[model samples]
Target: MEINLIFKIAAVGILITILGQILKHSGREEHAFLISLAGLILVLTWILPYIYDLFVMIQDLFDL
Candidate 1:
């Protein structure tokens, strides 16, 4: 929920896009794919804790 987290995610996405483009242009499409996948996983890891916390809060609110 912090602004910096959003910035960090955006920064990672930009860096990944740049790297992927470079790799693809260099004829390393497979590596570019892996880099994109890794970037996705990295972003998910960063956001998952917040998602889990939200779910927990919702569950508590509804007494689920």
Candidate 2:
């Protein structure tokens, strides 16, 4: 994990929160939900590789 990745995730979270708030205030609740979901998926994609590496390391540690 790198510092840059954490920064990127934080930026995305901030942007998504702002956007979702705007959408909700504008009565676009469904769109806000979608936007939040997209953000979650986006962040998950970004972190998926690290998650896989973690799992691999755990497996190695346990000799699984």
Over the stretch 1-64, how does candidate 1's per-residue lDDT look in tens digits? Answer: 9999999999999999999999999999999999999999999999999999999999999999
1-64: candidate 2 lDDT, tens digit per residue: 9999999999999999999999999999999999999999999999999999999999999999
Clash total of candidate 2? 0
Stretch of 10 with least lDDT, candidate 2: 1-10
Off by over 4 Å in 2: none
lDDT of each: 0.98, 0.99
Please report the TM-score between candidate 1 and the true structure: 0.95
Question: Which residue pairs collide in model 1, if any?
Answer: none
Q: Would you estimate the TM-scores of all the predictions?
A: 0.95, 0.98
Clashes of each: 0, 0
Clashing residue pairs for model 2:
none
